[model samples]
Target: MEMENMIGLTDLLAAAIRAWKQICVTMLVFALLLGGYQGYRQYKLATDPENSPEKIEERYQAALEDYEKRGEELQKKLEGQEESLASKEEYREESLLIKIDPYNKYITNIVFSFSNIDESAQLFRYPNTAADYLPKKIRSQYLELWKSMDVPRDLADGRYADLEWKYLNELISIPALEGELLSIRTMGASAKDAEDLAGAIFAYFDGHRDAIGRSSAAHELSILNQSTKYVIDEELKTKQESLDKEIEDLKTGIEDTKQSIEDLTEPEREDGYSVTAIVKSVAKYVALGAAGGLFLACFLVCCWWIFADRAANSFQLERSVGAPFLGAMKPSCPPAERLAAAVMGERRWRDPEQASAYIREQAEAGFPKEGKVLLLSTLPEGKAGAGMAGLASALEGYAVTSVLDALHDPKAVKAIQDCAAAVFVEMAGQSRLTDIRDLAAQVEGAKRPVLGVIAI
Candidate 1:
């Protein structure tokens, strides 16, 4: 099946090569028509003032400069806001007051410290394995924070979880105390949430103090007994209200500055391709048209060549008609010489010197060796008449009967009956296969042996 398909494709390619000129002309004409339509569209766009390339580029450049200027102003304003928030008298006073507030402590920075945590670690193992050995519930709660932040749950290396652990480590520090201690701290958006999260973390350690390892139990108990660390100051809580109000006002000012920047920088987009871009795109297509036109022309020409009916060579002619190729005449042979050869009944023979000799040799091979012989030509009118005359002249030794119109003549069989043998002459590529077949059938019906085909 594959071989057959390949052969068919090969034939199609051959046909296309034969008709390449016609195919190329046709393709170029179609490409020009298509290019004209596209050019028309480009003309309309180029003429439109609002959408033209120059206008769009000018507007874009203006917008870009404005954005850059506003961006610098926005950065300065934000820096000023940050400085105000850090340096204001109220801000300092509030931070100090927050240090002592019972409720403020819950939402403020909490610190956890681990002493002798890495004392027993191996060189190849993580220095802080205590974080990994946490109770299942505590570990799950810690992992939940990362999951809420959209970290993938199936990460085997737990890369994001490790990052979160690093963040927890940053919130902790160990003092060079004389004993082992584990401190855990947590903070949230409000006093209540922070208090709850911190308390939960602290409770996990408090409840698991005995599990800290027997070697550190005594030190752990000492750290847990520091109850005065939770004491609160009532005066700072009272002052926290005013400080909160001042902070809120500063935040509002910063937000207003941000909004102004956003308003200045918001993008102003223009629809559709820019005029320059459109022109470039059209040029690209025109180039593609030239390339595609060439390719299509070649392909179509190959198809025409493959499917062409005319015999391309003597070998092809012999194979197509299932005949022995006796001889052939060159297409470059002059028309006058061809006509002269036809007039002397010698069109079937290639060499002029051999014509008379071939005639004398074949004269006695068929019936009525000494009588009239029929010379027939498959070509039309002038060509056939010239050939018949030539053959009659060639067979001067015998009484030769010429029949140029024998192919369609009703009495052609009767004319043939009067002759001993018949000759069929034809041009190789010019004659139709069907016409040749019809002529052969006619000669067979007359019961005359076809001497042979003459390829001219």
Candidate 2:
């Protein structure tokens, strides 16, 4: 068998050399694609510096420094104006309250004093003049007595007037005297002038004490109004401008960095090959070429192997099966008749009684007695016509004739004409038997009686 012929290294090498065109094309395409892809990747890395590790680290460091610098500047600005900022904010709130309810008389004189009471409820009322007129101990006792009383409006006028005079005289005197002194000082008055001024102030207070208190409150409100507007507005504007400038500077820095990165990037090519386009093109050609080369190589090798094996076996069969072994007149007998005769005859020749019995049975059945030729043949197991001739020759008193004209030498047909009976063997299977049958029919139509078939 062709399979028994071992393939050597030399044969494999020869086959590869024979297929070198396809292999070289495939390998060259692959190598070029790989090298081109690597080169393009390197080009991309070289061009896009923003994508580079060194540039990225540098940008990160720059951003960190800028952030720290901005933070420090903001901290310094905040530290420099901390007290002023708080004062301006407080003044703005006080000014707004005074503007909203200026004539509500208790507003300005309501001083908040710290005590052991809960700080959340510290907004308690006190006599407006208590800080000025009475001695500290006496004022404490008076406030305690006032708190204990429950004076209602329907009380007798005399009784109410008595309490009111006591409270007013004790609390209002010192504050009114302080105001008179301030007026006297402002007028640059001598003793005579002070005394005269004191009389007039006292007379004015005596006539309209509540009106004087209201006027004093209005004066304090005017002072707060004059100062708060300029200070609060200017401070807020300055801080806001500083913050806006800082934000604008940070944005400019970011934009500048982004522009630098864009400048460092490679510009798009108009006509030159792009890395992505080159890689895709190379891959496409490589895949197409490799596939075509592999398929062609496989197909050619398979065809050569099949044809070579078939030719070799046909040659061997033609050489082994000899000619003119069957009887001459009837050159076409089916090979099975010959093989049955061979097996039966071999069995009978080994035992004469069986052979005689078989022959006697055929004779009794009125089989043809004109020729003693027993065509012995069989379907070939491996070679095309070898088994037919081998089996026929193995039978006693049988001349074997094997023909190989279908796919081998056709000269055996003339030798088959001289045989008394011809046996035809068809190899392979049913599909292959058509040609064998055609040949058999031609031979059997001649004067010779053809025998039965043998199949394997």
Candidate 3:
């Protein structure tokens, strides 16, 4: 007899073997469906306009053109940057204080004072009212001589050749004649140059001394102070530092842009084709589908086996119906060739005579033996197989009465009341275990003791 819970490993294995055809068919169906879908997808991809060779080539050409255009723009940008950087470098060297001698600078101060013919070297002209007029009259002529001296231009090829405009501007200056005295200052590359610039100023004045006298005869020429002092150009030095920092920042930006242009990459394109990968992919999907279908089929079979509630064997039947098991019909399988019978399947059958004998034996103990025995079943009259009739015929001497679906039959109620005892008859795989249980309850509830269950 089959025994244990529905999911017991050994029993489940046996059930799977019995239902192997269903599992195989499910797997085959799933594999074919998945493989067909994969092939269809591959064919669709191959036929798509977007994937056509001409379309792909057109896209490649567009991409290549864009790439070349980007490269050209980058090159132009780099050229512009380099040009700007070079021009800035030249300007920074020439205009910024980088070319100025901050540490080795020399300054000279020249002060010219005016005097009346009667006042001898007066710090302030007596009353000071004539002081402004005298200085202004002479200094204006003095400045004109200084600016038009051409001293710097004459020295430009010699000692001042390396000096930029910022430095050259410091080397000479034009003073206003709005003060008490006239003071002009000049910066020089060295102490010697400072003294020499002061001398050049004096020499130019000496040559233009007649012109100076002709312009300001009302004012007298006074002592000139040519005092040379050593000092640094701090403001120019600060500007030079600032310009250096800007040049460094520009250099960094150029380098970064250059690196970015270098790092630019061309778009990627799929280059080759192969059926090997496609075949492998299809195989993988088919295998996975088959495995899934196999598991699903097994699960369905297991659910039907467990919950369909069809009593499997004598042990299972007795427990479900709560009645003693007698026996089942013999040779229930249909005819088959010997080879098929041996190789494919078989059904277990119990002797029907044994079941009949048990019912008789139950009646002999406590009930009348000659009375009719109710042969009760839960199947409809038509589907309740000939096995019930055959069992009834097998009990030759007993007065037997057969009823189908006894729970629903009014005649079964009367027969069950008159009969000496009742025997439950059901076929495995066709009769439900729950029906047998309910029927057994109904019989016991009617106070007609159930003799036993007979499974065919």
Number of the top candidate by TM-score? 3
TM-score for model 3? 0.42
Using lDDT as the measure, which candidate wins? Answer: 3
- Evaluated against the true structure, the overall lDDT of model 2 is 0.38
Residue-by-residue lDDT tens digits, candidate 2, 1-456 = 333233333333334444456666666665566556656665675577565556666766676776666666655554545544554444444322212222221111111111222222224536564443222322233234334433222222222333443322221222212221211111111233223323333333234423433322211101111010111234434554564565556555555544554444332223234567556666676666566656667556545534333212211222223221121111233554334334322112334344344433433343244444323223233443444444443343433445544324454455545656654443321113234444555556655655533322
List the candidate 2 regions with Cα displacement exceeding 4 Å: 1-389, 406-420, 429-437, 447-449
Separate clash counts for every candidate: 28, 22, 0
> Candidate 3's residue-wise lDDT over 1-456, tens digit each?
234234344334445555778999999999999988986787677677787777778888889899889989888888887888887788765642356578767877777676663333344555646645645666677777666655655452355555555546646765664455666676666777677766666556646666666655544546467788777778877877877887787788789889978898896664422477568768888998899889988888877777666654455656666667665554355433222223323233345566566555654554445666788898876667677766765566767788997768888777878877787877654577667777877777778877776765
* lDDT for residue 248 in candidate 3, whole number 0-100: 87
Task: Return the candidate ranking by lDDT, descending.
Answer: 3, 1, 2
RMSD of 1: 20.1
Candidate 3 or 2, higher lDDT? 3
What are the runs in model 3 whose C-alpha is more than 4 Å off?
1-25, 46-284, 334-347, 350-368
